[model samples]
Target chain A: MILENNFDLKRMASQVRRDIVRMVYECQSGHPGGSLGCTDYLVALYFKIMKHDPSFNMDGIGEDLFFLSNGHISPVFYSVLAHSGYYDKSELKTFRKLNSRLQGHPTTHEHLPGIRIASGSLGQGMSVAIGAALAKKMNKDQSLVFSLHGDGELQEGQNWEAAMFAPFNKVDNLISTIDVNGQQIDGPTDKVLGLLDLHEKFSAFGWDVMHADGNDMDGIVAALEEAKTRTGKGKPVMILMKTEMGKGVDYMEGSHKWHGTAPNEQQLVQALNQLEETYGDY
Target chain B: MKKYTYTESKDTRSGFGAGLLEAGRKNKEVVALCADLVGSLKMADFIKEFPDRFIQVGIAEANMICMAAGLTIGGKIPFTGTFANFSTGRVYDQIRQSVAYSNKNVKICASHAGLTLGEDGATHQILEDIGLMKMLPGMTVINPCDYNQTKAATIAIAEFEGPVYLRFGRPVVPVFTSPDQKFEIGKAWMVNEGADVSIFATGHMVWQAILAGEKLAEEGIDAEIINIHTIKPLDEKAVLKSAKKTGCVVTCEEHNRYGGLGESIAQLLSTNTPTPMEFVAVNDTFGESGTPEQLMKKYGLDSSNIVDAVKKVMKRK
Candidate 1:
């Protein structure tokens, strides 16, 4: 819970972005675009905000819970979790390989810490996050629940169903963040479908809505702080985080094509050069 | 010894509600989550009594299912409440990935199952839930017969830690079982002990099996009735033992004949203890709006149907 508003979150996000690109390049089959874009949010949450011991314990009781709704972007989540000590940092090379805990999507079966639910098909993670938050409330623990979803994943009706249910049910202990990256697998999200007025939409759905620059660590830190302060007030909170499709990677940035595809070796090297090897490449 | 009898009938969903409330009191880790069907799933009492332990997840069954899976990682036992259809079919992938495959200990409490859901039509009635859930690797499937049994199954599965599919129904039926009868998962309940033919049944079908047993007994054909509550682990021992003794089997359920208890029984009998088998279940078809009894009769799921299937299987034997 001791999150420094500083530590150059942008630089940390840059390192996480490099991890996303390099890890995907090693795996040769992972989502890098959304992972790169969402690096700041994940980094800010795990490295700064979250109070978790990443020894990767199976029973994550008395600890904060995080669910990945748009789990295709496992690259960023894996990087953040690994960097924060959920597993051997060297395990990043095993991503998407057979028998790796870091699968192409998030799953708890592998006994990985920080991931409580297996999510690949979009729009289910928030409900599970609310479930854990409800469990925390029942356990009389004040730990919060955090989750992230893609802008395109909001098109799935389940998100709105969770949207309507959370506030009305007083799931105020959950803090859900949406990666409003405006780009998805096929193309730019507007071309795919306009995720129109996401802020007002969640507001109408009975959530206390906030907006922040997802790629800006300061904004993420500040918004997350506000999200925590808003809990226990009888309403769920959602942060509409606007971020770029491939934030730190120069070539992959703003490309929907990189959503599920991995960066090649040359591209990985270029991405790494742009980002300092802060924790050293896994 | 005195036998328990039913003076009245009640919906199995209420039994689930009672079980949920009891589990809430007994286990501090027990939590309930509903997908907007508070009244239909009958999770209102648990929600009211343990307001902090209850979660209203709106109509997001997929989300509700996955969330229940997550709650288990925190050592909290989550029982998900929803219609049989939405609980299984709508969110099969979610349950498969999170709860079943991940091996999370989430109790999937489904009500208003099969044709007995009535008036709401086929959309609400789920005839294939047993099949869908049984396919999962570590899933424990149970379809309780009556109020006491359903309530007992609910409380029992909470003690045995794992993923469970607890199926019950909407309509009021027989409440013959003892109020405090302890439920044993994957164990068949022998309601009658005759040698003519074995009637293996579950859910609301248990009452019909009892009625059919009486009718068969009246006709000089002795009948044996067994309640196959826990469908997945398939009480193979009980089923095979009874089938071996009887030499003929008739499987009855309010679900589809394809993946319901019958198929499992048929498979077990063919490989392990092959016996002539007949199924009194819904043939691959949909349900419609009608009284539950009317639907039971029309869809060939009533007591008479069980009698006919038994006689038919007996002739084959």
Candidate 2:
């Protein structure tokens, strides 16, 4: 369902944010900050930007594919995938439970339809996305491959290896976006390890770089659509999506405290009050 | 006693290259990835024939492993080639998460395994690879004896779905196995039958065990020799049958005795059938810069070592 208007996208984003908080609150564990921050971007991609099938297949041959590299934000990924009709939204209740398809970090081990790879250890998703993109090119399928990564994940060396590989091989069918929320578990990414000028870094590595406000649904949708236009031009695309550490709920925005903390009863009530039950709770 | 002979000596890595090309020809879904050791891995021919299907990952084993996992998502069988050390220890987490845990159909082809990697020293040679890989659930570990067996195993794994660790070596060895042999994943090949003692061997050690069997026959000991190619699934039926007949066992491999084929056999026999056993493997220690022959001799992994181990285990029986 291609949601053209901003109203539907915003409503969906609100519902996704509600789902993210509630899922974390139910489990009493999970990263909610990045999930809430990346809600609009995921909403825009699954609803408006990407041409994907709800009836999922492991070999996503003719359809666009998305991989969640920063899998700690599985709250948003699970919510988006469930809302996109990949699985029952009721399954969202079993996020971190034993024998649940939704693992703490996103994984395909349970045969989850939307997840294509297991990703808890950072810096591996870029290579996986590139491989899928290359496979698509080999199969003569023009559909794009998209992936999301965290800015702190850039600390891992494998990402640099993949960053060097994609453009050199002319992997133009890939669009990788980094959630530059600047917050990690210990503290901000700049304090933990400064990621100096990501745009210049990616551009120097031979990628066509773009920037967008990840919190703005309209901006995210426009940037993703524009990224599709940059495809097949002989270089991979990189989007430095700037967003707050947490968005929507008061007292959680712009703070790294909620990065991996589940909301308590009072906090859950406060968050639910802020995010309207647009699509109803699962 | 059954006799074995070879017309020529060949490296197992070349067999992997040949098998890869044939596997690629047989199934177009088979793709090859190398981390800047194309020549060492002997993947030149496969790259030549299917340049489009080949990926040069340029000295990044982690990226190569994860990419291979990704390729499996779109129905492509990706074979990642690198040294045994780099393939396992360097990118263990990558293999664990992306390939093994995810259940991706990725073939991790590793060359230069064990002390047989020769003069590159301890850093390059990996002796604990089998233990590391076998520990992972759902991982199929194979260490073929010679060129022909490696080739057959390479082709066989393409048809079998799941993550596979195919460990081969650098130095040329006797090509005694048949070229047309069918490589079964968990089936053990009985080389010479005897009721005295069962000699279980893998990789380069299999040839040593054969030589030991010949020597033992001359001594009237009558050592039964079995080639255990697949280390993970481990032909338990063959092992139990051989152990039951022989009453004693000896395991030989070019790896640490702590976590190699010997430990797996010991675990099996301790529970089901109690039997006397001796291990002809490197004691828990790192290898040094030396010739393959020198390393094999100094590390107590030669035919003489196997013969000595057989004699020692026969006494326990």
Whole-model lDDT per candidate: 0.85, 0.95
For residues B152-227, what per-residue lDDT tens digits would candidate 1 score against the true structure?
A: 9999999998999999999988899989898999888988887889989899988888888878878988888888
What CAPRI grade goes to candidate 2?
high
lDDT of 1 by residue, A167-262 (tens): 887889889999988887788888988988988888888899999998777888899988999988998989999998888878877888888887
Chain A TM-score for model 2, please?
Answer: 0.99
For model 2, residues A17-112, the per-residue Cα lDDT tens digits are: 999999999999999999999999999999988999989899999999999999999999999999999999999999999999999998888989
What TM-score, computed on C-alpha atoms, does each candidate reach?
0.92, 0.99
Worst 10 residues of 1 chain B by lDDT: B1-10
Best by TM-score: 2
User: What TM-score does chain A reach in every model?
Assistant: 0.95, 0.99
Candidate 2 wrong stretches, greater than 4 Å: none
